[model samples]
Target: MSERKPVVLVTAADLAPEALALLGGYEIVYAGKTPSDDDIVSLCGQHDPAAIIVRYGKVGAAAMAAAPSLRVISKHGSGTDTIDKTAAAARGIAVRAAAGANAAAVAEHALALMLACAKSVPLLDARMRAGHWDKAVHKSLELHGRTVGLVGLGAIGLRFARMADAMGMNVLGFDPYAKELPSFVQRADLDTLWKQADVISLHCPLTEENRNLLDAKTLARCKRGVIVVNTARGGLIDEAALLEAVRGGQVRAAGLDSFAVEPMLAGHPFQKESGFILSPHIGGVTSDAYVNMGLAAARNVRGVIEAR
Candidate 1:
C-alpha cells in the first residue's frame, strides 16, 4: 500500500486552478472563509493539517496550538506581519514567504501612482466629467528631472529605483540593512534623502523602529512641495502628520496604496484632500502578481510537505 500524502490546509481565499494543480496529488483542505480564533482552533483540532497556506488573515496562538501536526506555513505574499513568526519558530514550524514574486507588479503600481499624482489625472477626469474644461489649471510637473528617494532598497525598492532611473529621475536610496547600493541608485543618509528628494517613495516593512518613521519632524525635513509615494506599510507614515503636511503645502502630493487603517473609513482625510491619489492596496493586485504569488506559495507548501 502507498503512503498517504500529507494534507495542506488553505486558510485564505481559494487559489487559482493552476496554483492548485501545481500541488500534484497532495490532499487539499480549503477552510471556507476566515474562521474566528475559536472556530479555527476547533476546526484544526479535528482536521490537523500538515501545512497551512495563509493570506489576509491572522493565524493566532489558539489556532497554532490546535494544529500539532502543522510543520510549515507558506504565506501567500512577502509581508509576514500578520503571522506570528516568533511563536511559529518556537513551535518548530518553518515559515516561508513568496518574497520576489510580486516585486515587479508592485513597482509598476508605484510608478503608476506617481504618474497619476504628477499629472493630477483623477482630478482632471473628475472635472471633465462634471462639464468643466478647466484647461487653465496650470501645468503639472515632469518627472524627468526629479530626484526620487527610496526607503528600503529591497526587491520592490530596487525595482522602483530602476524604473525611476529609466525615466531620467535621479534615484537615491536609504537602507541601513543593505550591504551595498545598486549601480543605478545613489546611497544617502536618511536625513539627506529626506531633505533632498523631490519625490519620496517608501518600500519598507512595518516594525517598531520604522513605525511612524515619517512623523512631523521628518516631514519638516522634506523639501517643500515634495511628492510622496507609499506602496509599503501604512504605519511607516504618520497619517495625521501626512494630512497636516499636505494641508500646509509641505507635501505637494501623495500617492498612497496602503493606509494606517485599511479599507479606509468613509470621510477619511485622503478622500477630502486635493492632490492625493489613493488606491485600495492594489499595488500587488495585478493578474501577473496574483499568479506569481499564488504559484510560488503553492510550490513552497508542496516542497515542504514532500520533504517532510
Candidate 2:
C-alpha cells in the first residue's frame, strides 16, 4: 500500500505543472477566488490543509485559526500585505514570502511605465489615431542625463537603478534600513531625493508609517514637473493629492500599477484624467515570473511541511 499524500490548499486557479511536480506527494486542491471572509474560513476548516499557497488572494486571521493542520502560509510573490503574519506567528505557523522571484519582471514594468509617461506615448497615440496631429504642441521629457530617485533599495529597486545608470541617468536611492549600495548608485536622504530628482520611482512596501508617503506635502517638495512612478503598493501615494498636483502642473505625470482600490471601476476618474498612466497591478505577472514564484512558493510549503 502506498502512503497517502498530504493535502495542500492553493487559492489560485492553477500553477505550472513543473512547480506542482516538485511537491512530489502533495495533493494540491485548487480553490478559485474566495470572495468573502466566510468562504476563506470555510475552505481552511474543510480542507485542513497542511500548507496554504496564496497567489493574488488574501489569508487572514479567521482562516489561520480555523485550520489546526495548517503548518505554513506561502506567498506566491514578494509582498506579504494580504497575509495576517501576526496570527500565523501566534499559532506557530510559518509565513514565507517569495522575495526576488519576480524582481526582473517588476523592474522592467516600472521602467516601461516611466518611459511611457515621460514620452506621453498614450496621449500622442490617441491624438494621432483620432486624426489630430499635435506634434507642434507635444513635448517629451528626456531620460538621458536625468536624475532618478529610488525610494527602496530592494532587489527590484536595485535592478531599476542599474538599468537607469546604463542609460546615463544618475541614480539616487533612499532606504533607512539599507546596509550596502552599489558604486553606481549614490545614497541620498528622503528630503534630498524629494528636492533633486527629476523622476521619483517608488519600490517600497506599504506599512503604517510609510502609507501615503507621497502626500501633498511630499509632492510639494519635489521639483516642478517631476515624474512619479510607483510599482510597489497602492497606499504609498495619496491619489487625490497626486491628481491635484498633476492638474496644477506641479507634477509632470504619474505611472501607477497599483491603486488604493483594486479593480478600478470601468469609468474611474483616472481613465478620463490626463497626466496619469495606469495598469491593473501587472507589474510582476510575466510568464518567467509565474514559474519562479510558483516554484519558490512550492519549495517554501514543502520545506516547512517536511521539518516536522
Candidate 3:
C-alpha cells in the first residue's frame, strides 16, 4: 500500500497553477470561496492538514485546534490580521505572510482610488451616461504640487509614495518603524500630516491601538476638502464619522477598497453616497499578484513543513 501524502489546505477555491505545481507532492484541499469560520474548522477536522495557505476565511483557535497536525499557516497576501497569531504561537504553529507579494498590485489600486476621488470619475461617468455634460461647471482637483500624507511606509505605501512623487506631489509619511526613507518621503507625525496634507492615504494594518484611527476627532482636524483613500483594512476608520464628514463636505471625497465587513452588503450607505468611491477589495486580485502571492505562500509552507 502507498503511503498517504501530507495534506495542504487552501482557504480559497483555487490557486495559481504554478503555485499548485510547487506543492505537487502534497494533497491539496480547497475550502471554497467565502468560507465561514465553521467551514474552516470543519475542513481542518476532516483533513488534518499539515499546513494552511490562507486566502479567504479567518483562522482562529478553534480551527487550529481541529487540526492537531497543523504546522504552519501561510498568508496568501501581506495581511495576517485574519489569523490568530497568538493562538498559533501557543500551539507551536508557525504563521507566515507573503510580504510584498502583492505590493505593486495594491499600490496601483491605492493610486487609482486616489485619482478616482480627485477627479470624481464615477460621478462624471454616471452623468455622461445620463446624457448630462457639466464640463463648464465641473472642476477636478489637480494632484500636482499637492501634499500627500501616507500612514504606512511598507512596500505598498512606499510604492504609492513614489507614484505620487512622480506626479509632482510632496509626500509626508508617518510610520515609526520605517527608517532611512527615500529623500522624496518626509517623515512627519500624524498630527502634522493630518493638518498639512491635501490628500491622505492609509496603508497600515489594523491593530487594537489604531482601530478607528480616523474617527470624528481626527477627521475634524484634517484640511477641509482633503481627499481620503484607504486600500488597507477598514476598521481603521469610523464609517459613521466618515459618512458624516462626506455629507457635510468636511471630506471632499473618499475612496475605499476594504470594508469593516467583507462583501459589503447590498444597500450599504456608501452605495448611495456620490462622495464615496468603493471597490470590492480587489487590490491584490490581479493575475500577477495571484501568482506571486501563491508562490510566496507555497514557499513559506514548504519552509516550515519540509524542514520537519
Name the best candidate (by TM-score). 3
Candidate 3 structure quality by residue, lDDT tens digits, 222-300: 9999999999999999999999999999999999999999889998999999999999999999999999999999999
lDDT of 2 at 185: 91
- Show the lowest summed lDDT stretch of 10 residues, model 3: 299-308
Over 1-308, each residue of candidate 1 has an lDDT whose tens digit, in order, gives 99887777777657767888897687777766654546656667778878777765667667788889888889877877767888898999888998988999899999998998888898888889999988786588899978999998999999999999999999999998988777989999999999999999999888989999999999999999999999988989999999999999999899999888866899996898886899988898878887888898898887776784
- lDDT per model vs. reference: 0.86, 0.90, 0.96
Candidate 1 Cα misplacement greater than 4 A, ranges? 1-5, 33-42
lDDT for residue 110 in candidate 1, whole number 0-100: 94
Q: Judged by TM-score relative to the true structure, which candidate is superior, 2 or 3?
A: 3
Best candidate, lDDT: 3
RMSD vs true structure, all candidates = 2.0, 1.4, 0.8
- lDDT by residue (tens digit), candidate 2, 214-281: 99999999999999999999999998999999999999999999998886878877787779999999
Kindly report which residue pairs in candidate 2 clash with one another: none
Estimate the TM-score for candidate 2: 0.96
Query: How close is every model to the real structure, measured as TM-score?
Result: 0.93, 0.96, 0.99
